[model samples]
Target: MKTSIATVCLSGTLEEKLKASAAAGFDGVEIFEPDFVASSLSPELVASTARDLGLTLDLYQPFRDFEGVGQEKLRQNLRRAAAKFDLMNRLGISTILLCSNVGTAVSADDALAVDQLGRLGDLAESYGVRVAYEALAWGRYVNDYEHAAAIVRAVDHPAIGHCLDSFHILSRGWDPAAIETIPADKIFFVQMADAPGLTMDLLSWSRHHRVFPGEGGFDLADFMGHLLRAGYDGPMSLEIFNDTFRRTDPFRTAVDAMRSLEWLQELACQALERDGREGSRMELSPLPTMVAPVGFNFVEIRADDHRLDQVRTTLHQLGFTDAGNHHSKPVELWSQGGARVIINRGDSTAGSPAVAALGFDVLDPELAAERAGRLLAPPVPRDRGAGDEQLLGVRAPDSSEIFFGRVGRGGVPAWVSEFGGSTEVTTDPLVTRVDHVNLAQSWEYFDAAVLFCTSVLALDPQPSLDVAAPTGLVRSQVMSTADGIVRLVLNLSPTGSADTAQHVAFASTDAIGAARRARERGLAFLPIGENYYEDLDSRFDLKPEFLEEIRELQLMYDRDERGEFLHFYTESLGSVFFEIVERRGGYRGYGATNAPVRLAAQHSRRPIVAAP
Candidate 1:
């Protein structure tokens, strides 16, 4: 599959964008008009530079407001087209994208649009150029793919064809099945973008909120499947217009765009295979088989040498016992029932205690790492001691390591032997295994991280949610294995805040008993407002004693039709926190409704420091 991206999707000069795209393994680039207009280099120089970097000038984009006008306006538009065609000739580009007119279109009549497009086609043919007419979601007349394709067909010009954009087609709730009926030769170009579900105007959303495929709500696999079934064998280009991507590092954004394309192609291939059309004309790169993890094996925390004692105190207060010390390396293993926490005193100069790595138990560690590597996620290299078991780990976008291990293999079970073995058990503790892990990321890296989790680790991402935060709104998404294990709650921290603390939630059979034990041991619990308890009393018909117990323990509660949830958080120890949770029956959520209360309370206790 050929991949291309628009220059407007990145941040930098036109030259920089071209270099980044080539470096990220894209085959071509669509020159968005504004990028060329702002560049100091001539069109010839841009073309030559792209040639030197092994990139094709795929298409010249965005000749807007070209249809639906009187003869005088139509004549002027043709002249404008002539000028752009002359530029495209200089740049060695053939196809040009003409978006449906959203403004200054006098009529929505199909005959007028056909006539205007035919005139544009005549002008384009003079310069050996092809016109790919696209429907803008908010276009005045031809706002749908069917409408645009009908106009293209009516024009009957050899140089004019339909341009299909996934965002424009899918965002309007139009059925994509009709795409299979359009002849592939008439489908000039395909542009793709994914986006979070938003209840906003189409134009604003299209221009500001677009994301890469696999990071949003669109069923792009199905979308691409129909396009392939239509036999459109052109470059699948990216045309994202996101505010975040525009401000991020151009090289990183380019890499992420390439990754999204790879992931999308794999999904499309899988879809085709499921439909028993494995021998289709569409060719895709080979992908490793996906492996779903069973559950979290352990969580590793890295504490600054100075704060090691404080971290130890917090763990001990929560009823964890020192299970074993690492044979080599300055790491200690703390255990409470089935849950294990590895505290690594790595860098002494580090400012705070933070989550360093997560360990997951999968069926095949080697296979999982192989799949991740194929998806462009290389494993982190670690120097091993003579007896240390090798763990396959990949670094997340935020620089945290995610290690994979399997049972009855040279993985987690073998590594456990380095610690004094199962015979070293002492006293029983309150907390059980890890219920879920909460990772906080900046807005810039959020989508990339989501794609990594889904494509590399084979986790299924749930719908995203926007929760009220103390500073602003926070976006939260959960990714989990198919078997309901290895849950990861990713929090997109609001920009300009130091509230991106990492957390681990441990499951407890009796939340009240666990709370009392921690309290007696002097662990500082984040205070809850009395108003919360009052509201809980109003919401649920809990017994008076139960309400009083919740008020005394400062716990948070949420209930649904399936079950009830009770949880409480620890005061922030630098940039790390902890949660104790008790899930009654089949509660599948993370108590997102109580997030605002927790945020307000955390803000009240800690001084505000903006995130870097």
Candidate 2:
């Protein structure tokens, strides 16, 4: 599929946006009128520069408020459109996006609107430009795609056609099936955007909250499926208007936009294949295929000298034994049950005891890296000494490293051999493998993180949830592999926090028993309020003794149609926390229902300082 992005979606000068778009492998750009008006270059120079960068000026956009007005006002609107057509001719742009009258539309007469649009089409035809008319979600008279389509049909002019924007249609709750009836030839342009479900004014949401496809709540693949089924073969252009994207680096945002389109096209093709539909003009790119992880290889913790001993002691309290030391580096290996932890001292971590890296046991490390490269994930380099096995890792948006390696017999590498002593230790361990890793992220980087996991790591994104915090609502999502081997919980941190803290949850056969044992070992659990148990009793039909046991253990419980989830947390070890969890009868959820209580407890413990 040919990919294009709106110039308004990026930050920087027009020249920078064009260059970044070209470098990100986009074929064309939709020139927002404001970008051109503010540009230093002339229209001809802008066109020539785009040509030099191998980018096409796909569409000259957003000639707004043209139809459904008085006769004198209609004449004035035609003149305004004529001026833009002259500009489009100078810029070598063949199409103009005319959003339906969001302002200055006095008459709601359909015949008048049609007559004015037909006259404007005649004017556009004089300049060899086509008009892609779109309906604004909050337009004065035309607020729906079906209504706009009817106006286009009534006009029946060759130079005027429909511009289908996913946001405008999907946000208004319009069914896309009606699109199949609109002739493909009449569909002039297709613009795609995804957004989180927010209850707000439509214009405000459209302007400041649009996100890249697959990063939000919209079912874009289904929308694309309907577009493809209508035989609309055109550039799959992006028209995003996000506050964060407008301030981020232009080049980085351009790359992210390109990745979103590529991922969307691939998903659309998969949908088509599933439906046995053929004759699609789009072709999926060769991205890295999804590989199911056998399990977590290890979790690396980075610490400085001051916090090193505290980290070690905390691990001991939680039943981890120091197994061995790395032969060449200042690192120690610790183990409990089948889970491994690497404590790398002296690494320049953002905070004390931060999760530095996650190692996954895949089928082939080299092949996985190759796949990641195809998906445009940049590789991060590591310093390896002599006889050290090479590892393949991709740097995440939050600067965390994710490494992949082979695990089966004869396929495993000897990187662990560099450790001096035998890593094996025998003990009655309480926790087994890693259940999940919760990565806290800033709101600006949340979309990038979701796209990274879904596109590069081949994980499935679950519906986003809002967790109540002491400060505000925290947006949370869970992405996991199909076979339940790898699970990542991404939380958008509460605003104005110093830093986003990370947590690791380990699985156990009996979470209550593990919590009791750890408490007996002198581990200070994050205390829960008695009111929580009272509320829990009201929510669930549990016996009095069971509720009392939960209250004593300070454990959280959640149940759904599938099964039950029980978990308990430890007090903060610097910026990191730990959780022991048990899943009963295929429960596939984190204890989200208990997040408010946990957040309130944590907030109550925040150390306060006297003002100077």
Candidate 3:
């Protein structure tokens, strides 16, 4: 099923939000109330723009304090509701979010609240709109998903339904199993937000601490499993209210959000598979005819320098053996166990080694390409043979090629069986797969790339961010495929100069350990100030040693109630730098808190010549 995110997830104005949503692999977006209120674009115009960008307005939210209120307040709210409904109709939005009363009327009894909700539901029905009633965790009363669902059922109106928010449900320590009991039809919407678990006031925490999925500690896989089991097929909108996210580059933020969602998708897929759910199995098209004997096959890196040789040497020292060379490609293979790293000495002049291409082996390359093409654009063929093409290819946004070919049957290299060696084994574990790739692009090409990934590659768009410099410089646009395997970040340079892509981040299972290992290897990293962590006790109940170590190492951090993330940046190499991240428990986002620091470092290091 197609997935959608709230447009508010993108840190920008309404127009920018729509563009970012389209780019981020989102099938649709929930239009937040604030964006609509602040937008100069008419509802019709906004709807038209959404259509032009190939986005659906999945929801129009939120009508707050709609249930349990005084006569005068009720009248005022009804009028506002009517106006919003009209606007939604103009904007071609079918779903409306009605948040349960928070402050004033939350004390009202459930009966009164249900009666009020029924009236609003009847009104919504009049306008041909469905009302998604959401329970606020901090509400005066009725602050749980089951409770909200009960109210909706009590209201007994087709137009009234419950909106399940992952944050509210999990943060309140509610049982996720309750999801199974609710009728699937009663679920009008599903809102998701990941957070690092912390001992702080929920109000302050929810407003400032939300992160993207996979970056937090919540068991979102289990939550999604429950929903899937209940047959919920609705848009899972991300509603994060992060301080750093709002301040960072919108495009990059959106890309990060999409990546987080992609990770969640993978987790969900795994969970569903474990549960033996029908239609949950992920069968790679063109099953492998010859498997590489259940061992590490290869690890690929697209780099410029002999530095890649150093990386290879490091891998060798760690226990990998040289495999073989690609006939025409600039790639060499190294392997140990079931893992392999393919080092590509392809144009690393672009600064960091971005993933230039991915080569996968399948049973039928042609059929794999065909299935992929049906989902995305047809693969761009790169190699032709005497009788037929040897492999099938697809071109990604950065002009990199993704190739699929047969590997084992007559495809295995003679060197595969001859290589044997036991290299040094360190206690430190290397990163788990190339978690994701980040690409840099000019502003103008951003949307086109997003469209290519979404329409041609069949990848979903994730959430995004809008970043502006203190000098009022704004660069934006980010997109990623669903499943978080690929990410593309676009920047509209303030000076509008064309330059090669810079900076690439690799994921690590243990950020602190990686940093320590790198430090021991004599690599210098930027330091995080002590003042940031001085208030750790007040903000989070973390252990003193852990907090002190993080502060001393200059790690940046942010968390919600479910998980925490720690990240540190390395010295800039030209325009690029590296970020090492470690997620503890439910964390799922890159540390946005570190963006300003990284950008500041970049700005400081940039050569300063007198203006001509």
Candidate 4:
């Protein structure tokens, strides 16, 4: 599948944008209207440069509020569109994006809109250019793919086709299954993006907050699966509009965009295979296949002190039963329902408690390891013994060992079973498979970790950033295998000293529900301020009750054109915390706005040390 990006996604001079897109490995680009209007380069020059750089001009967008206008106004809009099409022809492009009439044309009747679109399609055909009809989430009458496709089908012109935008389709809550019904030939273009779900004014969010796929919470796999199943073999393009993404270094942003597409491609392939569709082998696999494909399998906590029993007791009260002690390892498993919590004694010599390692079950341990190895480095040999002990280990970029195995042999410990004494029979059921792993690494080892992940584990590297803080700038690098299952985030301390490894983020279906359940079980969490709610109310036009609930839960949030996201920081366990995310629609992203707030919260909770 050929991949492309919209020129508007990158922020810079036209030359820089073109250069960055080419460098990032895009086959083509959808030129945003602003980029084209602002460009100093002539259409012919731009076309020549794109050819020299081996990039195609996929589409020019977006002519908005063009249809259903008064005759004179419509004529003028048509003339303008014609000029744009001429320029596109000069630039050797063949497609133009026509956003459904929003504000001004929303009230126009469907028949009028169809007639106007048919005229535009006829005009486009005159120039040998195709018109891609897109449904804007905030569009007037046409806001969903089904509605937009109806218009396209009603026009019944060869020049008119539908553009499948994952963001718009998902953000509007349109069923992804609809793609299966549309004729593949009519799928002229495809746009993909991910954003964290948020409660904000959709217009404002669309203008300033979009995330790359995999960074947000959209089931792109399902969307892509539907597209592929329909035999829609069109150029896959990315058109993201995010304030943070625009402000970030253009080059790095381009690289990350490419990484996201690669991740999505892998995900699409896997989903297709699972659904019994024919596809090629995966480029990389980041997950182990030992357990069921959902929920937290186990939580690993590494501590420097010998508080395994204390920690175990805490887990016990939360309804967890001890699995069994490993004869050769210094680890013990505790379980509740399908969730397993592994307590690692790796740092027992030190007084601080930290998370050491995490394990996930996979369908095939060796294949998963091999796939992971291709993205980073070869897997390291792990010891295996008789009776349910079969497992393989791989080193992530952050130097943490990820163990993949089937169910262990031994039964639950008698003490734990007896202590928990209940009519409930314990059964070893596979929980949620491993989603991704985050790591906190020291500055000195940052480069080494990156190398390890790339050369040893064979994961793709994302652009690194140095976040400025009161103490100093914290540099971090994130690497993920092509399959999108394994993720390692390596963070370096600003002080240039060895830093403790801490913090983790787990994926979940419902954060609000999970938070409530965790609270009921006595898990402590930091409280969000009412001020955030006030800001949320003013920033987003959401209902008062929903805003109240979010603020009451201390959930941090932000939205983009794609979708919304929610976040919360845990109490200080050093500088570490967990992010529980629940994606609505197609949003995918960590709540970036909450980062500073969370950091400040952590700073406030830091223990005051006395001078010796």
Candidate 5:
């Protein structure tokens, strides 16, 4: 695929945007009109810069409100089109995007629109430019892409064709299969964007909420399939208008956008393969097969060299056994049953304990890592001595390392031998394995993290909701595999507070017994208020004895038609904590409804200095 991104999708001067796009491996760019007009560079200079950066000026946009007008208005619009065409000539761009008239169109007559578009096409032809007429979702009359295509056909001018925008088409709930009916040659340009499901005015959503493909709700791969099945082979461009992207570093945003396109291309390729399109006209490079992890191999925690004793104490109290240090590194393993936690005292200067990396057991580790690499995840290089166990890793958007490991015998990683090898030393273990991991994301990169989980990790995202916190509302999304293993909860902190610590929730066979044992071992339980238990009784009217036991244990509870859930949290130890959870019957969720209460409890016990 010939990938491109509009200059509007990033934050920078025009030259900076071009360079960022090129550096991110874009073949071309659509120069959004406002960005060009605001730039200090002339059209020739901008074109020259794009050429120097090894990029093609794909398209110039957007000449708006050019059709369905009276003769006088038509003359003025043609004059405007002439000016833009001249500009495109100077920029060495052959295509100009003319949006279907959104305003100032005096008529809705199809004949008038066709006639005026023909006149504009003549003007474009004079400047050796092609007009890609696009339908705005909120256009006055010609709002549907099929309607715009019909107009283009009636105009029958070689200079005029249809521009298929995924946002405009998908946002309006138009059937994309209709794209296959339009002749491929008539489809002059394609701009792809995705957006979250939003309830707002069309213009407002289109202007501000558009995200790169795979980051939103649209089925862009399906859209791409339909376009490809129609034989349309051209630059697949991105034109996102997001507030975050507009304000962030252009290079970073460009890389994120490029990653989205890479994922989208892979999805489209798979879609075509599913349809048995073996002889595709476009030669798309095939990506490695996606393989989801079967289970977590290990969760690594990093802290100052002398600061890990507190975290280690909590783990020990919670029934984890010391599994000894790595044979070659400053790392110690703690385990409860099959759940392994690696305490890495690698940087003594590191501030507090945090989840530094996660290793998962996949059927094929190298294959999974290769897929992640193709999806634009930066490969994480691990420093190792000879004869060390090699774990392939990639960096997530939040800067956490994700490693893929080969499935070991009896759920134990083969690399455990690199350490002293003792783990959980228990017949009837308290914590069985990692039930889920909670990662805190910065507000700006929350959506990007969601895409990373879905695309790079191959996890499916559950419906997202906002959990009330003492500071502000925190958006939480749970991503997991279909079989209820490998759950990851992503919490977007409203204020980006480091105090919003990352946690690992361990599944217990008996939550009550485990809580009692940990309490006996002196685990500092994050205290729950009496009113919460009072309200809980009102909500579920539990047996008095069970309720009393839970209150004594400081456990939180949630029940659904499927099953009941019981869980308890450990007090924050620097920037890391733990949760022990039990599911009775067939409970599938992470007890999300109690998140606000948990957040409140954690807030009530704050005050962590930067010092470890």
Candidate 6:
């Protein structure tokens, strides 16, 4: 299937959009009327530029509110349609998007709509062009796609066809199975968009919250499957109205848009295969085989060379022993059971230690790298010296590096030898492995990070939660594997302040004992006020001994129908901190109920950030 995107989905001039689309490997573009009208180039120059860039002008959109009017208004609309048809010829585009009437509808009669659309189609045929009628979700009448399809069938003109949009159909809770009822020849074009499950008005939701597929709550795979079964093989173009995309870098937005389509096609292809069908006439290419990571092999922290004492001391107090230092770089590796953390003192331009990279255990490193490359995620830059292992890596949406670690027969990573780690530990370590990592993200990269995690790392996103802060709401999204070996928490702060710290949580069989050991080492814990403990005791009616111990250690506790969770946070050293968590009896949450309290504690100690 061909891939296309509307010019309005990106930022910058029309020419820049065209170039970026081509760079991102899009086959065509829909010339959004406003973008074209706002450009200084004439129709001829625009057509020539697209031709030189090897792009087809797929559609000209969107002529609105042309039906359900009185005679004088109908005449005026036909004249307007004629002028647009002429402009389409000059631009070498055959299809024009004619959205259903919203504000200009005077009657609820389908007969009026059919007659007006037939006349418009007759004029379109005379000019050798086509009209792709779309059903806006909030249109006054003909909002239902099936209703618009019935109108198109009644019109029965050669130049008239219905444009199927996934957003409008799914958002309205319409039955997409009705799509197959319409003949393949009557479907002109297709548009794809995904949005969160919002409860606002349809028009406002469509305008402000639309996101690329896989980044939101829509079941796009099922929608695409129904379309494939309907036998309408056309361009899968993106028509997004997102506030962030419009303000972002056009080139980055275009690449992210392209990735969504690719991921969607793969999803639909898998759907077809599951139904025991080889595939449709549409040539949907399957992506590289997705293999979720087994577990975290290592995590790298970058800090200033002179500011490493606190980080080292904290790790030691948490029961991590110094494994070794990198042979070629100023990086040290520390280990506790299966968990490994790297302290890099080479680059600290940010003035604080932050998560710089992550390594995941994969069955086939090269194959995983190939899959990421196909999704347009660039490989993590490497600076290897002689006799070093061939390490493969890629960059995440927030610029963190991801390395694919290959293990030997004993499940030990082969690259650990490059850092001079000993063959075995001299003593037993306290924590077992990394449970999860909470990564703070800028608002611009939150959605992109979610999609990137889903497509590249093969992580499934769990439900999102809103953690209230004094400043505003902090949106938290967790992405992890089915068995919960690997978890990533992406936090969208209200201010997206760079000073917001990220934390690495380690798993321990006895979090209470681990907290006691760290406290014995004179480690400072993030204090939980007495008020929080008193409220916790009242809420859960916890045992007196357990309550007193937790209160003494500043450990947060949460219980549910399934199980209980015990966790504690360390005092922050710049933009980094540590956490030890114990999940008893399959507790799967991150203690979100206590997040507000934790947030308040951290905020009070943070430096006051003045208004810019």
Model 6 quality (TM-score): 0.97
Task: Give the clash count for each candidate.
Answer: 1, 0, 53, 38, 0, 2
Identify the runs in model 1 with alpha carbons over 4 angstroms from their true place.
Answer: 276-279, 408-412, 420-423, 426-429, 608-612
Error in Å for residue 137 of model 2:
2.9
User: Which stretches in model 3 have alpha-carbon errors above 4 Å?
Assistant: 23-25, 209-212, 242-612
Q: Candidate 5 lDDT, tens digit per residue, 492-569?
A: 877755546799999999999999999999999999999999999899979999999999999999999899999999
Give per-residue CA lDDT, model 6, range 1-612, as digits (tens): 799999989999999999999999999999999999999999999999999999999999999999999999999999999999999999999999999999888988999999999999999999999999999998898899999999999999999999999989999999897887888888999999999999999999999999999999998877877788778788999999999999998998999999888899888887777653422557788899968999998898888877788899999888888988889988899888888898988876747788889999888899999999989998877888887777799998888999998865576677677787665573555699999999999877688899999999999999999988767788999999999999999988887444356999999889998999999998889988999999998899888998999999999999888899999999888888999999999799989999999888988878776999
- State TM-scores per candidate: 0.95, 0.91, 0.56, 0.56, 0.97, 0.97
Model 3, position 186: C-alpha lDDT score: 87
Model 1, C-alpha of 609: deviation from truth (Å): 9.0
By summed lDDT, which 10 consecutive residues of candidate 1 come out lowest? 420-429
Please name the candidate that would achieve the greatest lDDT relative to the true structure: 6
TM-score of 5: 0.97
Alpha-carbon runs more than 4 Å astray in model 2: 107-109, 346-351, 384-390, 410-418, 423-428, 498-500, 534-553, 558-563
**Candidate 5, superposed: residue stretches over 4 Å from native:** 276-280, 421-424, 496-499, 608-612
User: lDDT scores for all predictions?
Assistant: 0.87, 0.85, 0.65, 0.67, 0.89, 0.90
- Across 430-473, the per-residue lDDT of candidate 3 in tens digits comes to 55433333456654334435544443344445555545443434
lDDT of 1 by residue, 104-193 (tens): 899978998898888888889989999999988899988889988888889999999988999999999888878887888888899999
| lDDT (Cα, 0-100) at 122 in candidate 2 | 91
| Candidate 4 structure, TM-score to reference | 0.56
Query: Relative to the unseen true structure, what is the C-alpha lDDT of residue 304 in candidate 6, on a scale of 0 to 100?
Result: 83
Native-to-model Cα distance after best TM-score fit, residue 133 in candidate 3, in Å: 0.8
Q: Model 2: per-residue lDDT, tens digit, 1-612? A: 778999999999999999999998999999999999999999999999999999999899999888998888888988899899999999999999999998899989999999999999999999999999999999999989999999999999999999999999999999987887888999999999999889999999999999999788888878888888888888889999999999988888887888788788677877786764654555556455657677788898888867877777777777778877877788888777766788888555545778889888887788878876766677989878888777799887777899986684543336666777664555666788788898888766788889888887778888888888878888788899987778998988677863335888998888888887788888888899989988899999998998889888889999999999999988877778888889999898888889888888887777877899
Q: Which scores higher on TM-score, 1 or 3?
A: 1
